[model samples]
Structures are given as C-alpha cells and as structure tokens.
Target chain A: MNQRSQAVRDLLEAVRAKGFDPGPDGPPPDRCWHEAQVEVGDPAQYPSVQESQES
Target chain B: MQVGELIARMEYEYGYRFQQGDVLLIGVNDQGMGGPQAVLPIEQATVEQQVQGIHEEVLPMVHRDYRNLIMVRYEEFDYHETNGFHDQFTASLDDHPGGFEVVAQYKVDQNRQLYQGYMDQQWASPGLRWTMPGKLPDVSAQMRELGYKEPASSEAEYLRSFQPHPEPGFQPLDQEQEVSHLNRLAPRVSVEVARHALATTASTESIEQQAKARQTLGHLVAYDEDARDAVAYDASISPAKKDALVETYRQAPAKQRPALAAAAGAAWMMSGGGLKAGRAIMAHAYQSTRPSDRALVTAAEVATTRAHMRPEEIQEAFGKEIGTDLEAAEAAHQEWERLYSSTTTQTETETVVETETVEEPDQMQLALEHQMNQPPAPVASSGPEVD
Candidate 1:
C-alpha cells in the first residue's frame, strides 16, 4: 500500500487498539488525513517528520 | 452500718439502664426556625417529639434512588369576579407562593437536583456508563493472569489497567504492516495536543533564544486566556499536578532532562494518535458485542436521547453523570434541546442505552461457521456525513 494508506492504517490500528473512535465521525479529515498519511509513509521518504530539536 | 450494706447502697446509686423514659443526649437543633407545629390533632405535645418521629421515619427507609418528593402542598385561589381576567402567572422570589418544597436528600440538593434519564450518581462527578456487548471474556481472564486487579469501586475503575491478554486471533503486524498502515495519517490532525505539549516545552526552554527557536520550528502558539476569560470559563490546571510533573522532570538526573522533554514532545506531537487509538481500542474492546463506532456515537446517543426534554427533566434523568460544572450542566441541557426538539412539554426524555451483554461466541469453533461473512462498514463513512 502507499504511505498515505499506511499512515491512515496505523491511526486506524491505534484507534482500533484503543477501542476509541478517533477519526472523522464529524468533519472530513481531508487535508489532515492526507498529512497523517504522509507521516505514516515509508521511513526513507517520510524520514522523521518528528524532529529531535525542541525550542 | 455493716460494710456490705454500705457497698449495696453505693451500687444502687451508680447502676442505671437506659429505660424508655431516660432522656437521651442529642445534637442541638441548629435550625433557627422550628419545624412546623402539628396542625393535625396529635397527642405528641412537643415539637421535639414530632421531629424525632419524622427523623426516625425518614432515616429508616433505605435511600432508594438518591432523591424523593417528601411533601406536596395544594394551594387554592378563588378567581375574583371583579374586572376581566387578572394575570397571576408570573412568580417572583419576593412572593413566597405556597408550593411544594420537593425536599430531596441534602447531598441530592447540593447537586442542584439535576437528573438524566440515565446515570444515577453523577452529582459527585461526570460519569460515563456504557454496556459493551463485544469485548471477549478471555481478555479479562488474561488481565487476571497478568495481575491486573480492578479497584474495589465503580465499574469504570476496572478499566484503569486494560492490558488485553490473549494469543490474539488476529495475526500480529510485521514491518510491511507498519509501512502499509502509516499511509493514512490526516496532517495537522492532532495539532491541539501537539500545541499543548509544545507550549509547555516553550516555557522551560533554557537554551539560547535563536537555538530554541531553531530547535522548535513549529507553530508559535500563544495562550488565549482572554478568549477563555471572555467565555467565562474558569478552568485552570491545578498547580499541584503541574508541580508534580516538573518534579518528575527535575529528579531524573542532569543529562536525562533534555531526552525526557524530547520524548514528552514526541508523545505530544503524536497525541492525536493516542486519541484515535484510544477510540479504536474502546470500539474494538466492545466490537464483538457493541458492534459500533467511536465514543462520539455513545455521546451522541446520550445527547439525542435528551434532546426534547426540558432542562429540569433532562437533569432528572441523567444528572448523576453530569458533574457540578455549570458549563457541563448547560451543555447537557442544550444537548437535550438540540436533538430532541419538540414544542410540546415533554414529560420524559426517553434515554435507552441497551443494557444487554452480547457475549462473543467461542472464536475457535466459529471460524468455519461464517467464513464468507459480509465485510464490516468502513469506519470513515459509517458516521453521519463523514465528509
């Protein structure tokens, strides 16, 4: 699957695991979801969008 | 007199039993206004006797549903035949028009006598009571194996440490699984949590300003206390809890503080994951039985159930689950009005949370029974107008 699909899956999995509904039961995730998809992508392409740097 | 005769006399003066007529010591009546004198013909000459009888009667009846109507008074007003209809509908505090006191227990009164169609004991705190028809029984057994003991309190307390143990029938995820699943994140999804985490980090950044700015290249979020104040919301984090966190950070030896903050920040950035994951787990936890979506569905069910009720009626039904916060009470009241809108005065708000426990069938044996079963509805679209 593409990275976007994977990220959504991770979130879905997390939500599934949590037994809590996290996604758009209300508003469409659209852009936010697209970004989450990118984050969940393969490590090489996504790298760590999570920076170690802190302010 | 003989020594035995003197001893007998002393014993007679000291020894006494609490006979029926013996005056009992009691707390003095603090009520400035004495209880109403018995208008009904009665032999009990004293008000104390009446109060004692009333107290005796009320105290013995085991508290049934936290509140009760103690008295109901009837008022008669003859319509004067003078001028055309005079308006007397409006009631003011100054006018003590004889009406029912509707005396509930003291604790019940303290909660403002709010009732919800469900949740009986919410006066103390906001409560969540749901019956999950899904979660497997073995999960509880496994927790027992892992020494997960539930607190001897409410059912929700049992949920404190939910380490679901079992050789999950579902296959474990692999590296490919990780890559495949990461595809679905909605960007800026949990910025709220991320922002909160970062905001806290910003306060403690001891590094140089430029370096700190470079290190944290995210949104420079500011506190909107003014807006919060405008809303008249007085929700301040208790200093004690924040101090505890700061202490935990400080105590973790010199070099570890940076790493701790980074971890905390990372955890914050992905906080949306936590909410999402939490909801999913809660759903799956009840999946086999409840077969539904997220917690919002449950909350919506509550909201919809109370939609038509008058504020007082709604409180009467599920007031126990609604906490003391005026905002919370108002929100609950609004939830009742929003979904259950009705012109007619609703006597009751019908809140029906299915209480049946639908035990999941034995997984090992049922594998073959429904192999070609229908696929479950996709999560994204199941909710009302997901887009």
Candidate 2:
C-alpha cells in the first residue's frame, strides 16, 4: 500500500485499541448511511446524557 | 496515523481540497487534555499551504494526542436551486474510520425552519452530535442545551406544527372501530347525494360548516378511488373549482407528486375521455403544460403510450406524434420505460395489498336481505285500518 493507505490502516488500528470495533473493511454497508441505529465508537467514552441524567 | 496525517490522506484520496469557510471541529477528551477545537481553512492558499496552516494552528491545540480523537468538517454546500444552500457536516471516528460519515445535514429556509436531516432516534447519543455552528449559531446552542436537559419535543415536531393540517380527524379514523363503521356506511351513500350536498352547502352554509361538510364527504369516499373521481368530475360542481383542483395538483412538489397523482389521474380520466381513449389526452396535457421542453413531452408521451401499447407497437403509436423521427422516439421510449415501468409495477402490488387488507361489507346485499325478511308498511292509511 501507498503512504496514505497505510496511514488509514494505522488510524483504524488506533480506533480498534479504544475497545470499539469499526466493523469489516471497505466502509459499513450503505444502509448504515442515514437513519442507521447502530451505536458506533466507544459507548463508554461517548456515554448517553440520558443515562447520566437517570443515574 | 495522527489526525494531521489522516486529514492529508482524506484530501489526497477523496480529491476534496479544503475550501475557504470550511471548518474542522476536533473533539479530544483523552488524559483531560482537550475539549473542542475549531480549525478554519486558509484563504486563497495551495494544498500544501493549507496543510502547513492546519499544522501550525490545529496540531498544537490537540497537544499531539491522536487517541480518542474525533474530527468533523462543516462544509457549505450549494445545490443551485431555490433556497438550496446547506451546511453539511461529516464525522470521522471509531465507527467510521475509513471515511467521514455524514452526521448533521440540514438547510434553513427564510423562515428559519430546518429541513432534511436524520432524526435523534437514529443516534445512540444524539445530545453529543454537533450541527453547523458557523451558519446556524442558534442550532448549535440548541443542541448544546439538549445535551444538558431533556427537550419538550423534537425539532421536527416544532416545525411541523406551523404547516396547515390538511386532514383533521385523520388519525382517529385509523382505529379499527372507526374504520369498520366507515366501511358499513360507505356503500349506503351514493356519490350523487354527497355531491349535491356539497353543491347546495357551497351557497348557503357558513365557510366553517362547508369546510366540515367537505371533509366529511372526503372521508366518506376515501376508500373508493372511482367514487372520488366521480364526485370530482360531477357536472353540478363549478368549473372554477375544478380548475383550481387541477392547478393545485399540477403545482405540487415532485416528491409529493406520486401521492397526489391519484387526483391528477382522476382529472386526466375525465378530460382524457377515459381508458378507451388511450393516452392522447395525457400527451396533449404534457405538450400544453411544458411546450418548451421537447424531451419531457416526448418522455411523457412515451411513458403514457407504453402503458397502453406493447413494445413492438410503440413506434407505430408514436408515428402520429414524432412523425418519422424513429431514433428520437426509441430513445425517449427507453428512457421513460427505465424510469416509470418499475413504479407502475410497485403501485399495482400496493393496490393488491390494500384490497386484501380492507374488507368492505356489501351494504346493498344486506339492505336487500332486511327488506325480504321484514313485513311491508300499510299503504294509503288515512286512519287506523280495521283488518
């Protein structure tokens, strides 16, 4: 791979280390575009304000 | 790779060179090191110059922290139509590491109403989401307020309340009991009775009462497209009212046209001289409505003709319209077939589904049975008759 492609791979690795699976390669399916309900990134890091309010 | 490297890669791979007024929002909360930071693009600069500017201005703000970093860009998009400017923002994070995922995409009209964006229910943490802070400063403030406290209602609901409610009591009729009652009453009422009532009430009743009567009649014939068409085309109704209805359907937005086409089709059916006439009126309407656009007229004629004729017969049918331009006719036919054939098939499928779902009781048959079972009323009885 070229420099930019390698850089993207390295970025993906760092994201994976944060306990959030970025899913399989080549971007999530197009259905994940708009109105997708899947929780992305680390839920622990980006905690819901609703959960905070309830607690 | 670091955030700076990732930004460079995005420019190289996606060919999206940074433009002036584009802002990058960096969110970092690792090791208590960072809050939110905004990076503005360098004006009238080369790619290298902009990258150098970003390195100088933005890198130090994040304190060289790459982990737990989220980057989003707010880009101004001009769609080149009426009130078409919008601020489109996309985020690159753990979930969407390969490329940026569109987060907040909306446009504000002259009235400051928002349109075209995903709902909060689609997001796991809607409160944390950021809108365009540069163009719509109030929206950003509202989103931040939402992060701290519960909102009374969604932004969409607030905007929707301003629009005129076309059909009152439309929601209550969704209940099983209401629908069943309507089904029982529907067949007993003739189209002539409803039309006569509306015509008479148009002159005598108050505006509010007339509106209510129209709404009631509309609901009564809602399930029967043919009955609705008959009412619309009735001779007793004023010509101006008919013209107004046609104009309203014609001026409806393209996205709403599919739903409103039933009303337009009713007008076409009456004016076009029914199914036996075979698309000549539709062709005439298209020609008259948009005479300047030859391609649109050709496409509409082809689509309407194709609905009634076979593929082999389309050219013969089109001989009257195009007059020996076989190539152009073939091109228009192919284009419209590609666009509209699937839509026609889908509509037919939906009709079958609707027919299966709504069970209509035969009121005429039931009335006949009741008359057969009951005793007849006394004829010519001026006083009590002695048997």
Candidate 3:
C-alpha cells in the first residue's frame, strides 16, 4: 500500500479504538454526483438582504 | 468496498491530499429508506473556510436528507506540525446523526492540548468512552496542572477549592459551627474571599445557617467600603441578594449611610432599576447624612454623575441641592458634545473641499466665463503692444 493508504488505515484504527464504528456500509453515497451541481441563487432573492435594504 | 477503502480510493483517484488537522464527515443512508443522502469530499482551506463550508454545504445537505447516518473522522498527522493539536469528539442521535448534538465536538479542537493532557491523566484505561453523550469531563484540575492560571479569586473553581471537603464517615458542620467558622475566616480574608465563602455556605447549609451567614455578610458590607463596592459590581451574585444588601445599607446609621450610598445606587442600577431611581436612592442617603462630610458628598456626587445622565435627569435628581461636582460634570458633558459637533463639521467641510478639488474642471465653460468677465482682456490680444 502507498504511504497515504497506510495513513488512512492508521487513522481508521484510532477511530475504531475510540469506539466509533462507521457501521456496515460500502462505497461513497450517490449524492457525490450532486456535489458538482450546487446551485447559486440570486442575491436579491434572499429574504434577509431584501428586508435589510427595505429597512 | 468499505468506507475507509472508498476514502483511500477517492484520495488516490482524485489526487486529494489530506493534511494535518483535516476533517472528513461522510453521510450514508439505507438504499430504499427514502432517508438521508450523502455528499462528496469538501476541502476547506482554513478554519474560517471550514466553518463557512459547514454552514453553507453540510447543513443544507443534512437538512435535505434528514435520514442519513453521518460518520465523522478528523485526523491530525503529527503533533509537531502545528504548535497545538486537538482531537474532535462528536455524538448525535443514533437514528438521525447531525444536529445540535455535534456542537460539543466542534469545541474540542480549540483546547486540544489541555483536553488531551486531561484524557491522558484521568481516563487512560483502554475502551473507555470519555467523550460520551451528556457527560462533560472536569478538566480544571488538568488546566491548573498545565499552568493555565486565571486571576486569583475570580474563578469559581478557585473559590470552590476553599470549601472543606467532607471526609469518609465525617459528619457535616452544624449551623453554629458554620457561622463561627465563617466569622473567624471573614476577619482574616479580603471581602471577595469572605463573600465567596459565605455564598458556598449559603448554598449547602440550613436556613438558620444561611441567615447567620447573611447577617455577617451584611456587617461586612456595611463596615467595609470595598465589600459594598464588590457586591454591587459582582454580576454572579443574584439580584435578590443585592436587593437585600441594599436594604441592609439603607438601615445603616445616618453617619455611615453616605459611604454606602454609592454602592447601594450601583447595586440598584445592576438590579434593573432605572438610573433615576438609583440617583434618588443616593440623594436620599446623602440628605440623611451631614452635608459637611466632604468624603460622603464626593461619593454621592460620583454615584450621580455618569455619562448617560442627561442635564434634565441630573437637575431632577439633585434639584436645588445640586453641588459643584454635578455642575462640573454637566459642563464637561456639554464640552464633549461641542467638541464632537465641531469635529464632525470640520470633517464634512474638508470632504466637500476635497471633492471639489478632485473633479476635473470644465475648461470650455471656464474660458467662456473668463471671456465674459475680463472686458475683452483689455484689447491686448489685438494690439500685442509693449508694456
């Protein structure tokens, strides 16, 4: 294994030793694909900004 | 693949490097449960970046997918990479996983050294869950051991250390003994120490014991100027106690009332009584005492003369008996206002001048106005005559 993978393994060991079980799961969540499409809404549409300007 | 395996694969494939003090939180949900969803790796550049990323990214994702079980792993590579290193311990509801429950874990990294040293000293045994939910470990002893010192008697922990620890099979002190014990200690220590001791006794002792302790405290507050001032300013003391103390001052002899007047006024202010009421209390106390007592007069004046007091309020508080001190305070306040207004006007004038000077002139308009005003330039252009 590479140095990075070895480091990850060591960290996982410490985490388990500290009683944190990631539980039975495999692969990253499907939401990983949605990360690329994070929406950027218009600033004027924000309620707080509009309220502040009105005030 | 396992979660760790996938993280390694993601790091390798995407060339994502994890540095010291990096945190990674992964959310997972059951496939068909219509529950929480997950997100990809978020790489925050700094502490501020991470905070913003969590607020903007992690929080919304969690809100959208409320059913996800989040597994958070924070890694610090080498202790020496930074001057300080801290561990993060987070816990959430076994069912839902990311909400207000995660606040405690966020605080862990700020005091890493003290916490790590504390955990090492106290709970070094294997498989112990030291940072379990609803359990906050006491680290004041470890903080002291690590040479983290606060002001001498200001800290609650320091005050608590003065309390006598009950031994095994030892009986608690009786009311008389407790009062006697406090009386003996009250004369030797400063007013703050005495106050703290009395407070400690009042919390654990019987009602009669509390009354005796309060009576002794009243004596200290009446006789000792520092004690009265300390009690007045102490925010930790309850408003009810301050009210009682102010009553004690009110009942003091006319000769001693002036000295206690300022303290009483300050206490009144702290108890949410308006400044008007506080000034009235001071004025009443002053009226009871002889006006010849200059020290008492000064104390009353100092109490009454505050920056927030308007001229009208001062006039109403002191009435016809307004001393030179009040007049001087009023004059000083007026002087401050005058200076502030003058400074503001000067700044506004300078800004206007700078704005006018900074703009490029309309050369054509200026030339036309110059031609109209100069009476044909004295016909010098046509003649080109000698001087």
Q: Kindly list the interface RMSD, in angstroms, of each predicted candidate in the order they appear.
A: 31.9, 27.8, 30.3
Q: Model 1, A1-55: lDDT tens per residue?
A: 2211222233334344435444433222222110100001111211211121010
Q: What DockQ does each listed candidate score?
A: 0.01, 0.02, 0.01
Q: DockQ score for model 3, please?
A: 0.01
Instruction: Report how far residue B349 has shifted in candidate 1, in Å.
Output: 52
Q: How do all models score by TM-score? A: 0.15, 0.21, 0.24
lDDT of 3 by residue, B24-94 (tens): 33333333112111222234244344444444444444454333322322342223332221122222132
- Candidate with top TM-score is 3
Q: In angstroms, give how far residue B208 of model 2 lies from its true place.
A: 1.4
Candidate 2, residue B220: lDDT: 39
Instruction: Give each model's whole-structure lDDT.
Output: 0.21, 0.30, 0.32
After superposing candidate 3 on the true structure, give the runs of residues whose Cα lies further than 4 Å from its correct spot: A1-55, B1-188, B197-206, B235-238, B250-262, B270-272, B287-305, B309-387
For candidate 2, what is the TM-score? 0.21
lDDT of 2 by residue, B1-387 (tens): 222222322222111233334444333343322222334442345444444443333333333233333433334333333221112122212243333222333333333332333335555644332233222223234323423222213223322322223543222233465345445543324333334323323432344433333443444334433333333333112333333333333333332222223332333332211121112223322332222222222222222222222111222222122111223323322332332234344543553344344321222322343456531111111110000
Off by over 4 Å in 1: A1-55, B1-174, B177-361, B364-387
Residue pairs with backbone atoms closer than 3 Å in model 3 (clashes) = B36-B67, B36-B68
